[model samples]
Target: MSAQSLRHQLLTADKPGRADLLFGYLRAHGNKHYEEEGTQMQHALQCAALATRGRESATLVAAALFHDIGHMLADDPVEANNPTLKDDLHEELGANYLKGIFPEAVLQPIQLHVAAKRYLCTLKPAYYEQLSEASQKSFRLQGGPMSEQEIAAFEQHPFHKAAVKLRGWDDQAKDVNVEHLEIDAFRASVLEALS
Candidate 1:
């Protein structure tokens, strides 16, 4: 199936588990990657789970889960370095692709994951120092260190805090083992909650 079709299906998948989409992405597109210490898929799922556990809203959790769906859609592998000579702004790419499919509730956080990372660096003393060299480079490529106006604007977004927490998890998710719930429509209540 084409990547475009797959994303359409995934957006409307009868049973859309963050883990399922992520695992699918890993099996299909993930090349050896580095974002601190984990694979790209690992980073997204961890971010979602971390947000959920922190009592973040369902929109935030959904954003965490689907944030990197763009990586799967990118023209080439984007982990170690750009797979293509052209730009592979996975964060923006992911958010743009997702906005067409998911509600803005979901799209907003997905879009902000990168910003969340940058924002975290400014706030979390050890954050930048702990990033892998590749991620450090990627951060600059992704637009490092939000300017005062940019940071202020970014911070005001509704789900900003959860986005930051998810990014922190994104950075750390790959460094460890990942466990996940199997894909099934979340309990009706869970689905309703997210919807």
Candidate 2:
């Protein structure tokens, strides 16, 4: 199906049908990966799976699944193919697009997940060393670790904790060989969170 058609389906379809369309979109457009070990779809599935396994809220699981979708939706060549390129701010782009469709529970985490990475680096002295090569590269483009003031301010956001947890799962989601729950598994959760 065309990207436009799939997007339309995602916006207007029923829960189960939306799941199928989302899965189709992921399978088609999620093949590109600049830094991570797996395809974008794999990483998304893994992140959502982690959230599901942890028994996080349905909105959180949906947030985890859709966090990086901005990367796929961006028209700029640099967005998906080169994280080392200008910090495309895909998080903001994705979050903005989703805001009209999902509740704050789902949208807020996507907006902050990138900052969560920066915050994690500040909170854990050795966190920078644990990042994958691509993440390490993107870190510089993404403003590196947060400053003390930045951390202090970031902590004030209501979704800060959830974003941090999502960031952790995002980091862990790059394992190419890991088993993952199917995208359709979250139909109920995603549907519930859809605005």
Candidate 3:
């Protein structure tokens, strides 16, 4: 389906229909390469697997699976990955797109996951060194690291901890060698998250 059709489905479909449309969309577009080593589908599945292994709530697991969806939703997903472009703000775009379909438990973490990266960079200088080269470049595009005030505010958010955890999984999810569950494995969680 075209992006317009998908958006229409998301806007008008029932919960199950919305989930179906989203999964279909992912199946269609998720094979594209991400900024890192794995395909976008691989990253998403890896992140969701990590969340499930960590025994996160269903909502959080669903959030992990779809956190980078804005990259797909971008006018040009390939270009969105370019660090030289202004930060795509994929986190906010994804969260906003999912707002009505998912509860805050899912949306908040997706929204804050990028900020969580900046927060971690501030909290642990060593963390910056650990990022993949592509992530490090995008980090600069994403405002380098957070300030003390930004950290303070991030800490105060209700979902900060979840976002931090999600960020950790995001950092780890790029391994090309790691095996991951298929997108269908997340169907239950996705359906459950839909409102």
Candidate 4:
């Protein structure tokens, strides 16, 4: 579907239709690579699977599945992997788009996942080295490690811990060999997250 139609669906569709549109959109355009070892669809499914396996809340599982959706929603989705491009602020874009559709339980983690990465890099120095080369490059574009003040504020967010967990899943979700459940597996979680 065209971006215009997708936006229209997101904006005007009923709850169930929104969920269907989301999964359909993912299935369609999610084959695009975004600096990960696997396709965007694979990464999303893997992260959601990790969240499901960990017994996280349904909202959180949905958040994990849709966290990087901002990449897909971008005017140029491939810009995420372009070292020369600036930070796309995809977290904010996604959270903003999803505002009316989902509750904060789902949006907060998506919004803070990037900050969670920055938080992790500071809280655990070794985490920086564990990042993929593309992630490392984006880390620089994403402002590297968080400052002391930033860390302090990040910790105060209600979803900080969830965001941190989502970040861990995000980091590990790039495995090309991992077989993940299909998007249909997350339908319930996605529907539950819908406002």
Candidate 5:
């Protein structure tokens, strides 16, 4: 992608107006995350800020903030007997999107969040147990229930630590107030630079 186009996607836009626009644009009934009990945009902000609280780097923080940005455009069903993250894995989508717009530092955390999820499910028994049913089910579909060997191998991956941290913050971020940051600020920052 060109520099300008890459520059554009990194921009965040999810507060009030952008949130509504995102909902209108991305939240169709068939869409899974739209009616998934929490606002998708709110979820993203919480995840991002949560990571920041852990003294995580800004890239990881940004990754947390926009971790599920792709899900805003995800294809999930709201009321299905079997909930699935079967659509495009938001991690890859969000990571690729980040790659186009941000540095590898940012893209790495996003790309690895799912792996982080899988890794956590393996090492932390209670941790995996704590996941929402939808989240737990996702681990299976997303290559969860990893074997001992798989877990051992995963530990060696470069981003494994960051991914794990991202996962923790991602889960702990389920707060109403944490979503308070203005996406417009991040959006304006990126847009202003490009403009």
Candidate 6:
């Protein structure tokens, strides 16, 4: 199917259909390895599973699932191997692409997830130390943590806490061996959050 048609379908699809399209997309493009993790799809599933296990709202769980989808849009060979090789700003890209399909509750976390990473680096001195090597590299490209002023501004956003939580999930989602729900498992939650 064409890109336009897929977008329209994703935006207009019922819960199950939308989930299918998302799954198809991930199955096709999500094959790319994400740093040390197995693949992009694996990471997404792990993130969503983490949110589910944490008993987060559907919006946050969906946000966790789609957070890095922007990366799927690009076929950057170097980036697939070296995260710091490129900064595609996947957060903004994914949020913009998903805006028409989901509500602010879902979109905001995807948009701010990167900022959440930067914010965490600022709030916890040891936080930066815990990041994976690929994460550490991307952290530099993402502005190498936030300044105090930036941190204050980030914390003031309505979804600030949620985004931070999502970021934590994002970081932990890299474990390849973790058993988690697949994309289709979020069908009900995705349907509810659709705009």
The TM-scores of all predictions, comma-separated, are 0.70, 0.86, 0.91, 0.90, 0.67, 0.89
RMSD of 4: 4.0
Candidate 6 lDDT over residue span 1-195, tens digit each: 654356667867876788778778778788888676579888888998999889999899889888888888546442234333244578887787676788999999999998998898878868889999999899899998688899889989999999999999998988877776767788777777777
What is the number of backbone collisions in each predicted candidate, taken in the order shown? 1, 0, 0, 0, 5, 0
The TM-score between candidate 4 and the true structure equals: 0.90
Task: Please give the range of 10 consecutive residues that has the lowest summed lDDT in model 5.
Answer: 76-85
The parts of candidate 5 lying over 4 Å away from their true place are 1-35, 75-87, 176-179, 184-195
> What C-alpha lDDT values do all the predictions have?
0.62, 0.81, 0.86, 0.86, 0.58, 0.81
Ranking by TM-score: 3, 4, 6, 2, 1, 5
Compose the digit string of candidate 4's lDDT tens values, residues 1-195. 655556556779987899988898788778988876799999999999999999999999999999988887675554334343344688987777677888999999999999999899888879989998998899888998888899999999999999999999999999998877889999988988788
State candidate 5's TM-score. 0.67
lDDT of 2 by residue, 1-195 (tens): 545444445668766676666666666678888677688988999999999989999999999999988888685343334333334578987787665568898899999999999998878868878989899888889998788899989999999999999999999899988887777787888887777
Question: Compared to the true structure, candidate 3 yields what TM-score?
Answer: 0.91
Backbone-clash count (model 2):
0
The reply for model 2, stretches above 4 Å from the true place, is 1-18, 75-87
Give the per-residue Cα lDDT of candidate 1 at 153: 92
Tell me which of candidates 4 and 5 scores higher on lDDT.
Answer: 4
